[model samples]
Target: MPKFSRRRFRQAKTAPHRGFPPAAARSAAAFAALTLSACAVGPDFVPPPAPASAGYGKIGASTESAAAAGGASQRFAHGRDVPGEWWKLFHSKQISSLVAEAVANHPDIGAAEAALRQARETIEANSATFLPQATLGDSYTRQQVTTAQFGSLASSSSSSSSSTSSSSSSASTFVYGLHNANVSVSFSPDVFGKSWRTLESDTAAAEQKRFQLEATYLALTANVVTAAITDASYASQIKVTRDLIAAYRTQLDLLEKRFELGAVSQADVLSERAQLAQAQATLPPLEKARAQNRNLLMAYLGRFPNADKGEAVDLSGLRLPGELPVSLPSTLVRQRPDILASENQLHQASAEIGVATANMLPQFTLSATGGAQATNFTSLFSPQTMVYTLAAEASAKAFDAGSLFHTREAKVAAFEQAEAQYRSTVISAFQNVADSLQAVKHDAGTLRAQVAAEKAAAESLEIARAQYRAGSTTYSIVLNAEQTLLNARLARVRAQAARFADTAALLQSLGGGWWNRIDETPASQAKPTDIIATSPIAAAIRAQAEDARDGR
Candidate 1:
């Protein structure tokens, strides 16, 4: 309910000293009266309240995730603010470097930055509407006019006088050079807040763009982290598969010797050979996936598919964060960029309603022009040649086939639509956070079970090999044990990778610490390492980026 100042019209110094006519003076007084009485008309915008739910999960439920290898139990620290560089929590050098590279060189980030700049400029342009406009002009023309065109009486009198004087007279054209100069001033006061509403709409639009830029930053960093984790996961899987193939080939060798010695049937060797081929088949797909993941990482770094990336990563090097930050439901609405952007759109829609309503009322415009005119350029500014005029206009549409009324109705509908969209965005944001929280929790339990299964399979495989060597167990038993062990190992690797990826997802869902950033310009210009060097949380990773650059 803030009151805005009215834009007052003032006469320019170049205006003629004679001032305005009586009618113009009366109109000016009326305009001033309207300006003082007018107010911005429409429903003022108010932000939607946060959802009534207190917790992301069932009431009184624990927010801690189960413990597993490569990560400890992760607890959601409610009301804790996220760090500016949330990726540093992983403590991985390769991930930090990749994210920094993407932020600096990605085309999408640049485009978003440019869009924000454009929106800011538009707001600035719209602000100028509150100022009066003045223009100065000068012109010279040479023209001729016939005496008869002035009046029939003047023509007839001149002709009669010529006849009486015994001289013939003709309607002659008079030609002269006329010069004129003038300065004009005009202003349309926002008596009903129409111009102010327009400015408000533009300002809100700029705010929306600013939030979108932050969203872009958050998305880009999260994607880079996810891609790096994928690259590491695929590499680990491929290596484990190749090792399994080697074990199978060795087992086949022993089976073949036993068959030659008449201790085993030929069928056993054939069966072992088939298993070895199957295990070998698994390698090609893993290799293909690993290659594809590498290319994707390069793309995320804004490089070509075959570009030289100096270092590689696997699950072995990346550490899962033990602590996670979670904002309160009320804070989530403020922290999330998409939600904030939606709220700004709602604000703009509310302002539009005011603009539409103002259009249906009377509009006031005041203008003045003063200048000099003379037949000779030297006499243009003389007192006798001076001329001036002033005017004011008030206009209101008497009838327009209900167009203005319908337009206001449309604006009201748009405001309602924006409000609905804002609510939807808030609901979706909360859903994202809830989903990530559950994934992190279950991923840990899966990893713990997979680890135990892998250990038991290894023990079983060792016993089966010993029993077969002593001629106490069939080759089929050893084959089954070997296959189980291989499956367990692959599952363990995938589980470890999942833990890392889900941790990153949790950070993204919580808005990626955009609030910690002071301004948008820094992310676009400064390197991630440089920006986070002063933070204790990022000190270790900052060293890693520096070391990588130094070929350490």
Candidate 2:
């Protein structure tokens, strides 16, 4: 062995025992840790109590129950409100079509749907905490280096000369390449229930979004129905105004004859003309309002506001069912989508308090990883080249100067704020139902009075025509009777429209006709509510709706 220099020499380190921690062993450790914290460090979640029955005002008995009592069970009974297809109660095909379009295409509704999708994706991402995360990777690298030492070694002479040559020799070049490929798996066991808490919070937030979607739908339908009713009313008023203009024109013609006969002053003719002008002016605003309402309906259908393609729905043609299909003391507040959404918000706030509280205690996580590495590509798959790591970490905010405490306190305040907001929403719903009920009743009475006045005016106009024909009354009396009849007819139209408007408002205040169904739709038959309630958290709230209906 005369000090021979080998062409190549390599050293490799292998961890033959390297692999993921034993599943049973790691599982046992995690179970032991979590079992010790059976009562999580944070405040355990407690759902907000259901809205109390007290303080709700009297708003007439529900007519929906009367309809149900008639042995109609195919549809929702008195307390059988469901979520999807709630608008079907209106029994208007146009309404159904418009709602379908809105759900599919309305920008706001589309945004809400996108938000729901993102929430589902977020749920999937968060689920990684409970499952292992895996990664597969490959790397390649090349590099060049200058080596003056190699150049000097080739020119070796005397030892001293060789040493000097090593210092002064031109640089030499070296090149090499490396490739590495590996697949790794990692996990951090949820020993402290932090992941569970996060899941709970996210679940609540997703539910809040769902209920918000429902609220938006409810509001949109309300706007559409109300606008349609208002438009019909204006159409009726326009007709009345046009008829009044005709009556005024006839009166003015007669008044001009009276002036030529020296029976009435020219002032009387001018007065008649002015009355005709007033009637003409009244028609414009009513026509404008009617057109505006049509535009609104188009907009609700997700079309251009001034779209001229569709036939305007006549309010008179729409017969609101004689009875409503809702309950008394109006669960409207409890069932309203906005209110339900707010309740979900309160829950999220409650869960957040738990999260912030958990931060006060030490958090423990059991982590594990497994992979393989080797300089030789062929050895990469060998057990000798495999690598594994198992670790347990304990962390805490050691010195945050009471930041955790303050955060927890802030979450507590937020929960209280949400609670107050929920209560306020309930109160507002009650007011709406009460006001709408009163409106319905008063509008009904007013319509009756208007009909009576119309009859009286018609009779008076007939008497005036007879008296003028007999030359016993001045033309002015005929003109006055015509004006009176015109006012009464327009008043009747206004009253009728008012009745429908109030009825629609009542329906809106009572959370429409769909809040009474108890059964949740399955995935196959799943509608909007089903899709929204897909999450366990949203399902829980929907279940609450059924429970409350059952007086639970």
Candidate 3:
């Protein structure tokens, strides 16, 4: 309980001028005393406990590299804290720079930052309610008054001219200016801590927005890094296609010369030419994919496709991060932005229950006005014309078909809903981490298989070419071998790229290390590229709460 008593309402005799009976006055005073002597009404929020589960449960809490996935091994360091700059672990300056550029320029980040700023400002505005509100006002008026109503019945019979003069003298109209000025102050005494609860709710709402901003940053930075990886993959695949095309052309040239020497049939030469054309055909689509991927990259950088500066990366440039972090399940619920945001919502809803309960309780207001009134502006503050008023009001509503009670019940339901949602968010976050972990483990297997197949196909292609050159096999066999190598080569590039993508996804699922960011309030300001400030730990729990009625 906190008290700042200006005065207490005293019960007195119900005189003719008294507004309420003595008994009612006493009841109000007692209510005020009891409420003022206690803390806020309704239950305070307690953060939900983290789950007791020790591991990511059958989802490969820890993993060792498969023997077949050799060279593609990623060591998952369980219970390790993810670094704030996780992308830097890839050791790609290209990726790091691109992420920085996108963060600085993205309109979505600016919008999210603005939302967070607005929420903070709202809390600032609500803080004004904690103190007395004072207003100063002045006004003037001009009007006319006459004394005709106070005149006696006229003496009619003796002299007409003298009677008319007497009447005119008794009733005269006068015009005058009127002026008034006053300063009035009013304050609500939060006997039940309605003010405190309201502030608590608002603060929670602000926190929710901050978390939303963090989520935005997490999504943005992760997507940028992933897109860059994909772009590199596309470029790598394109180069592989061109190399395959070149190989086919060389084989086709060899077959055409053999046909000219009558060492091979014309049909064999035609088959080799067809294979070369088919390999060439694969080039256009790969080029298209790479071009489109570059366009997507341009968009992420907040630029038009035509504005691209040919900022492209090579697959060889990105070093696969050797060490990867895997947070404990308990830590993830707190670190994940969505979960934290949901928790804030629960906090806000808990506060709302207090607000609603307070609304149904007695409310008290104190006000005072003191100033002066005169016939002119210069005389408005004169002592002789001074006047003042002091007032204390107490009110409580009763039995309006139970609207306030039902409203309070609604807030209870909302709190329950928020609690459930918080749990749901936690489940989804863990699922994400599990899914990424699986990708990290299995993508390697796919890559290893593709790499092996590509090697085998290349060997067979060489053997077929040698056999044809030695007149040991048909030219058609060489064409078939070339086709197999092309497919295997493309598959290997894809599988290799999948490894990078999976690593990025896993890092993202672990919450992108936003809690370790350098800037706590960077979203509102345009910081430098290297500031690492666009993200913060989700400190907000957004409340889509229904507004509770406050008894004023």
Candidate 4:
């Protein structure tokens, strides 16, 4: 057992009754001793290993291409002039507004914001473990006592009668109230840094939540952009199909006239009518799909998932950019919020291990409580009635049913899991960027080829019309050429929209903008986009979001 000294508690007893100087001096001395003697028992925290190089499946993004693009020196690269408002690159005001609206009012985003607030509160709660706790209380009681006739009878018959005549022994009742007032302060110094490690872990968890929120936001924005593009593309396809149907109807009229005149077979006129019906049928479904996509966009914006009456979602107002920005390396990985969040989680897990190890060591706590007491309420404030108790405690687990050992093992496993997840996140992020980059590139090429095919089909249709007028071809030839051209035009529109969607996806995966958008550090730097890493921008957003949740 550790020895105790009176001087440690009642320092003023040895000297004159002064003010709080002696108490303060004793407190300082005790703190110094605790600081000097304190040592944490658990394993020290060390960040889990992250892959030196993220292993990404190649999709055309290579070191040579990145270097040639002037982003070679960067660890995570990206193209420049990738405007912060990337949605604007598609040149659609409606799309931009929808994306903005979704970010502001999305239900999932709101839930994530609430979770982040809870995480902050959790950190604050955990911080109390390092400080002392005290509670104040009071109570009152009443009691009554009665004399029994049996006791008097046992004494003597005359005595019992006399006692009864004197006084019913008088039923006695008493009431008393007790009021207790005291202030207690306790401190279990982190000699071994257990508290510090715990704080670290919590900080990391908070960051993870932050990044998750950011990732969700980015994905939602991308969806809005993609949906808008698809809607417009469908509309364009409908127009092309309607035009083709009109052309086929004209051809059908001419073919029927020729068949009546014994110039063409009934089969030829029938083929033209069938082709016209097919083209006309195509318009309704395309329109329906466009409407459906618009509803989906509204849903993402936290609006009711139903079509609005005359709700005009203008896809035609959007413009596509001529070229996609291409930067590589230091910019791409650094700005990725999810990857940074993963890093924070790994750090948090490392801290948890430290906290678990600290459990194995001796724990020390210092406490002091003082209050005045008296039977009479009037004397409660008198210094003469004051009483105090100050003590220190130290304890160590001598035996347990393998609980501590298992806890340490669990934390270790958690640390490893965090590490693996971190690496996987990094790898996946890289793959997404690479795939999107290649998609946009190849889709553009496909669009050019389709354009050429459309031109050829249109020429063929014109030639077939001239040949029919010259009496060398039937209406079926003209209908076939028009149909081929219509298909090519529709295909081109889809490829164009797909290219835009791919570009938006790449931007979202690369964390929304150029390298300047993200902070590259072992300790994550927060951003407006940061859901997990403590970027200053994200912090403000989180504050605003939490304030909204609290109805502030």
Evaluated at residue 17, the lDDT of candidate 3 is 12
* Candidate 2 lDDT by residue in tens digits, 354-465: 6666667677666565666665677778888777777778887879988988887787778778877877877787777667766765566677678778889999999997
Q: Which candidate leads the pack in lDDT?
A: 1
Give the candidates in order of lDDT, highest first.
Answer: 1, 3, 4, 2
User: Which scores better on lDDT, 3 or 4?
Assistant: 3
Assess the local accuracy of residue 371 in candidate 2 as a C-alpha lDDT between 0 and 100. 62
Better of 1 and 3 by TM-score: 1
For model 2, name the residue pairs that clash. 64-324, 64-325, 80-516, 80-517, 81-515, 81-516, 81-517, 82-517
Prediction 1 TM-score vs. true: 0.83
Cα lDDT tens digits for candidate 3, 428-516: 88888888888877777777777789889999999998988798888778888989998997887787777788888898888888867
Per-model root-mean-square deviation over C-alphas:
11.5, 13.5, 10.0, 11.3
Backbone clash tally (model 1): 0
Best by TM-score: 1
Instruction: Write the number of the candidate with greater TM-score, choosing between 2 and 3.
Output: 3
Question: Candidate 4 residues 1-552, lDDT tens each?
Answer: 012222222111111111222333244332332343244333333333334454434444322111111111111233554666677776666776777777777888777777776766666666556455675534333434444535555456555577656545554455555445567777777766576556556766786776666667667778877776777777778877887777778778887898899988898788878888888888899989988887887787788866343333334454445455554554454567788678677667766777777787778898888876665667778887787899999999999988987887787778667767876777788787777766665665666677678778889988998997788987778777877888887886676566567668877866875233342222223543334323222232234333433454
User: Whole-model lDDT for model 1 versus the true structure?
Assistant: 0.72
Q: Please write out the lDDT profile of model 1 over residues 170-219, one tens digit for every residue.
A: 56688889898999999888777676567657666766776788888899
| Candidate ordering by TM-score (highest first) | 1, 3, 2, 4
